[model samples]
Target: MEIQLVGITVLWLFLYGYLIVASVDFGAGFFAYYGKITKQDHIINKLISRYLSPVWEVTNVFFVFFFVGIVGFFPDTAYYFGTALLVPGSISLVLLAIRGSFYAFNNYGAKDNNIYMFLYGATGLLIPASLSTALTISEGGFIEKRGDKLVFLAKELFTNPYSWSVVILAIVSVLFISASFLTYYADRAEDQKALELLRGFALFWSLPTILASFLVFVTLRQHNFIHFENIIVRYWWMFVLSLFCFIIASFLIWMRRNYGTAFIFVLFQFFFAFFGYGASHLPYLLYPYVTIYSGYTNETMGIALVIAFILGLLLLIPSIILLMRLFLFDADYVKGKK
Candidate 1:
């Protein structure tokens, strides 16, 4: 009925598209590793690397562009939207970059070069540091109100809670980076002893990242952290559900022999995350900052959503068909493997 409502609906539908693509791709990757598919079958690796991986990567790029375009259209809303997206988007980007770098290193035999290894390790650390800094600034801890203007003083910025969050994030980031390096070195050595050590490091260090993310969400909710009351009301339940799903999925992943089971669990995790995010931020393109009613008010936008929803179903139906074909007819690829 209104422009803001229509815009919010379209944005959320786009996000659903993104979640579908991302979950499938991420599930495929997890199965590839869990099933040791790469070692057993080149076809499986090729399917993942050539098809699924690119799909996720392209989708991620589109996600970035989609938000960037929205912000461009509504400059006044950019700060709030950017603040909300900074932490999660940056985490995904950095993790994907590290994974991509690892793929390149393996493909090109950069493992033998100590300089290359050093650079890779340094890049990994830098990703987290840069993200932490961005998240801190985006959280608005340094801004001082001076009658319709926000000013940042260096001294205030340094002493803010955002700064402290950055420090904590940085510490966790280093742990993760170190874990990655350890795993890389272990792989290069091909020594069972080294691999075991690295695996332990990875498992231990990974927990902190998860914990930190949970803490952030918890604090956000406790403080009524973000703007927009409706988002807080609807999505708070979803976040709670997501935390439960994460714990359950992590346990299932540890115990399950069938990699497909673990893959499914991971998809559920993503689905929960998507639902929480979308539901919480509904009726507003950007929470705490911009609302749908304020941005645009055209019936055309509503019609567009109806049309897009139909198109989404069309696309989704075909994907289900293809997935069924793979599940039933392509048994050779997954059977006894998971």
Candidate 2:
């Protein structure tokens, strides 16, 4: 209920928004290519194209807000994370550019170039894997303050089990989330062929998502015992709820019933787990280097930022809802009747 708490919570919401929206966008790109290679593009590509057409351009808006808000609310993170993130951050940007290029070329010039599809698909996986490095580094041990110089342990990050686990989880979770949503969308469109194919894709990725989640928790115990203990002690219930949501979602998908409900459950699954992990990691933006108390901006600025971000969230959510209503869920548009 402090300003810092409100500020970070708002920022966390933006990041969570990005997690869902961007995951669907990213996963759709990968699935588009996968469908092509598997010769199912004829079945699923229309659904994927329809979903991507209206939303791809806005997928990074939440991310942009979170990145800027974090630095605005917690100036000290810039100092700690700025240099440490340069390589990985640069990689993410490059991958994003490549992905965007594919979108541009496909939309404007070359409709379905295999080379462009490969780049699109590759970036879909690589961008998330690269962006996840920041979260892995946040668990500590990957950044060292030697004198006044902050050195990023790139090799250690590459070799860390927890880092790899998080990357794997990021990719798998994207696939699962995207597939679940697309299955729902295809069903809503009543595209039976696409619906059936996407349903299978959703079921196939469901187990990997849960397994990768457990692997992250297990690896976290060894990687950062303090954070792991905090999760076990203070955050177990949220994770339990997250798992419950996952089970319900997966079951619905498997049963071939209420695909929309299934995706909603998946949303809650990540919502609980994402916010819980964030809440437990609270106070500290990055282990040992910064805490909300130590690193937060002054009261005047913090209050301004908290209010500004809260307003931003208010506006952003409604805009997305309107987008869905107008484009995503519109009776005629969704079914491609118009």
Candidate 3:
């Protein structure tokens, strides 16, 4: 029974995982393009601007297809997957990776600096990897029968060729770090005011990521409590950590004078919280009553959800496209208006 249940979990996990990745890619592209324009970089900025509309269009289409897949073909899947829930979760992971990568490659690598590069790289990679791994493992493929002890799926992913990909990702991440840091710090000595503002902005943008770290840690602890025995002080520590994260986020927002940083922080925090909320009640995709596989197999509701999903995609796509266009071409017009 456990094995069968695990198999179903894995299937749903793959779906969620893919959704998360897609959302993250879309979000990162949005943020990156917007950030470049704000920094007044014309070369790469122009290039991203041109492509923004198309990217948004693609994202919208993808979501529509995803929604259709969920609702039309697998109405029962809704009980496990939920509407657009995994989108934010996956996107958050991608944004983290992009942030780390931007810091490593752009900030640290260009100057041949390694410490900041490593710090950001590790933070970015480890957190996303851990989440992805946990999700994958919970789905059931990596559980090995080793004398009643379950070896996690993450351990397996790390051992496989995927580990090599991580090394490459590390390198790319460092490059992005170096680029971003160099750009920010290049004129810092010449422009003290700008530097000060930038620092404040950095802190503001970081609030969500900081809070996310806490949320992820608490989540892991919760999972351990459910699956394993003898884990101590799980709920108590989670509450403490959550409070700390909230305080830090509030403080950063309060201190921020720049709207850009504050906006990014708020947006990221929303997604982070959304994902965190969804994940908190996992192993039971449908709360209170239906488990992932047990009670979610009704065909009629599945078709309705699929239609809803498709409609959602149609709406989301155009909005994303318009947003990209605004960022790429009309960002200057919108900057202070908001």
Candidate 4:
């Protein structure tokens, strides 16, 4: 009900947007390359390329909005997370640059460069792995404030079990989310070959996604008991629903029916879990460092930001849907009739 809560909820929605869109973009790159190596490129690469061509340019818009909004709405995050995120943030940026170069090179320069494809595929996984550090660091053990300086324990982060677990989850979740959506997208395209291939990918990653989730929860109990307790007591229902959605999604995918419906369930699966984790971690943007109450901007600025982001969301969601209608889901375009 408070401005801070509302602000974060909106930001969380943006981040969720980034998660789904970018996962599809990222996993498409990996699948694109995987299809190549597996000698199945002729089967699904066109489908992947079609999905990426229009959507890739906009995938990061959600992320850019979230990054700016977090700092705008919670200025304290800048000081607390800035230094702590330096290396991981830089790694992600570099990976992003490499991934972007693939777009340019594949489009104009070298359409079939193996080196470029490798970078494209590698960054697909690497970016998410590096970015997941923010969530891991957020569980609140890797940063220290001493005297007048804020220190980031890079070694501690690398060595942390929960950190690795979260990274693993991010990679598998990216693949899972991407494959699920792409399966449906392939089905929409009526490319039975691609649909079967992507459906198999979706099913393969399903169990690993759930397992990685449990590993994070188990590791959370030891890594940050307070947040873990919050998860158990306050937000367990969200996770339960997440699991249920996963079950429905997996069953449908396995049954090879209603691909679109299955992917929607996959989205809900993560929506419940993601927001639930976020809701339980409420108040604190970074444990022991920044709370939404303590970190929020002043009321006037906060209201301005909230409205701006809401408008941005309103614009973004419709733009994507319209894009789908115009290009992605167009009867001609999707089926290669055009």
Candidate 5:
């Protein structure tokens, strides 16, 4: 395979890491706030807190890697996406800052402030929704080149069915993914109340997750027929595998068995769907405006960056595994004894 393909594949892996880790973190925040407002904080918030304590700080590492890697490997994306993404990117950054600050305040300072909790929960949903615009715009039609200036069609983005579908999918997927993992975590900790509550959430969101995924497909067909056709003709098997994983994961959750294994299926579900989407959208970083061949960095730089990022992923994965072993899954730690 070409170096550019290897580069984007590695970067996609980084983004996929963010999709799982940050989903759990962000979903936990929303669930924490939900528990407080529903007067069930005593039942589930502790479990949420335990998960968040050691995890939130590392949630953005994957995102940072993807962001920098994309720019490093595909320098032209900065030129095309830089102008188009200014508004949405700024909003995502602001929400991220707000989410982090409020998380700190709610956890360490006020401990139960409604305002802080609301910000935490709201940002959890909003950040992903906002960040998803890049993918939406990538399908093309939302950015216009006007005399060397790429104008992002904010109105078109807001009005497009495909864009909203992606946003809805992002939000629901986060909740479903988060709930599935939390259910597994609750079971591991033997917190029956938390387990039951989170299991309910996991089941409740499953239908919406699948439904929203199909909704995106339908809208993508209408929005970008060529890419949609590519997916149907060439990438159908990947999506089929994704659907299979979803079914298996949902079934395991429903049966209340092997919660850890169920969460692994959840990861596979997204793994296939997410990578398939990226794979099908390949060669074009931003439809019509940029292609891998056009936007890629110098061969020397690309080779060096690819090796560096591969090493980074190698280091990052074990670090997370060690973190999980030491804190997240530790017997005393999960039980809050630590």
Candidate 6:
């Protein structure tokens, strides 16, 4: 394979890692707060807390790698996206900081302030919505190059249906992914009450997730017809497989059997859908502006970065597996006996 292809594939892998890990983290935050409001926190919050305690600190590792890798691999992205992303990027950073602060406050400081919890839940949805601006802008029309200065059209972005569709999809997908994994976690914990609640959550969010995905497709056709055509023409099979995985996952969850296996199918669903969307969007990191070939880093740097990230992923996955074996899935630890 070409060096650029290898480099981008590595970067995309890092990003995919962030999507799954962060979705669970973010969804847990929202559910934590929701449980508090519903007076159901007594039953579910402990389960959520146990999961977050071990995992939250490391949740951003994948994102950090992907963010750094993007600029490292595609130098031109900074030139195009840097100016356009100022507001959204700043918002994402602030929200992320707030999320981190919530962990500090919840774990080390005060136990539960409604205000703090509210922020936690709100940012869970908002952070992804803000960060999605990069993808929305890449569809073009949201930014214009005027002479040497690039102008990010805030009005256009706000009014665009496609932008909102992506944002909605982000929010719903987070909830669905998080709920599905938590359902499995709850089952592992053998907490029937929490399992029932989270299963309801998983099933409820599944519809919206699928619906939002279709909305994205419809709006993408309107917003970036060329990319939509690429998806339908060349990459349709991946999305069909993604849908099949979604059905299997929801079915198993609905049947209340093989929760672990159901969650695996959920992972597969997103793997196919996320990569399908990404693969279809490719060659252009930012449509009409930066592409893999036009803006890639030098060959030596690209090769080094790919090797470093592949090594990073290799190390990261094992570390997470060890964590699961030691804490998350451990009979004693998972049951709150440890």
Identify the runs in model 4 with alpha carbons over 4 angstroms from their true place: none
Candidate 6 clash figure, as a count? 0
Clashes of each: 3, 0, 31, 0, 0, 0
- Expressed as tens digits, the lDDT of each residue in 22-98 for candidate 4 is 99999999999999999999999999888888888898999999999999999999998998999999989999998
Which candidate, 1 or 2, has the higher lDDT? 2
Q: Largest lDDT belongs to which candidate?
A: 5
How close is every model to the real structure, measured as TM-score? 0.53, 0.99, 0.31, 0.99, 0.99, 0.99
Error of 6 at 129 (Å): 1.0
User: lDDT for each of the candidates?
Assistant: 0.47, 0.93, 0.40, 0.94, 0.94, 0.93
Give the alpha carbon lDDT tens digit for every residue of 1-338 in model 1.
64444445555555555544543444344433422422432323333333342243354543553464355444555655444445545775777676566546744665334443344434434444444443354444444556875444546545555455554545553453333333333343333444454345445654674676555555445433562254456666765665675565445434423334433444454456556655565444433334555644345644554565546546755765676465422444323232
- With a 3 Å backbone cut-off (N, CA, C), the pairs that clash in candidate 2 are none
User: Cα lDDT of model 5 overall?
Assistant: 0.94
Residues 283-332, model 3: lDDT tens digits:
44433233545544455654455445546546755766576466533544
Off by over 4 Å in 2: none
lDDT of 5 by residue, 143-212 (tens): 8988977787889999999999999999999999999999999998999999999999999999999999
Model 6: how far residue 32 lies from native, Å: 0.7
Q: Write the per-residue lDDT of candidate 2 for residues 1-338, one digit (tens) a residue.
A: 88889888899999999999999999999999999999999998888888898999999999999999999999999988888899999999999999999999988989899999999998999999999989998889999988988898989999999999999999999999999999999999999999999998899999999999999999999998988899999999999999999999999989999998999999999999999899889778899889988999999999988888889889999999999999999999888875
Model 6: lDDT to the true structure: 0.93
The lDDT, on a scale of 0 to 1, for candidate 4 is: 0.94
TM-score of 4: 0.99
Report the C-alpha lDDT of model 6 over 81-192, residue by residue, as the tens digit: 9989999999999999999998899789988888889999999999989988888998888888889889989999999999999999999999999999999999999999
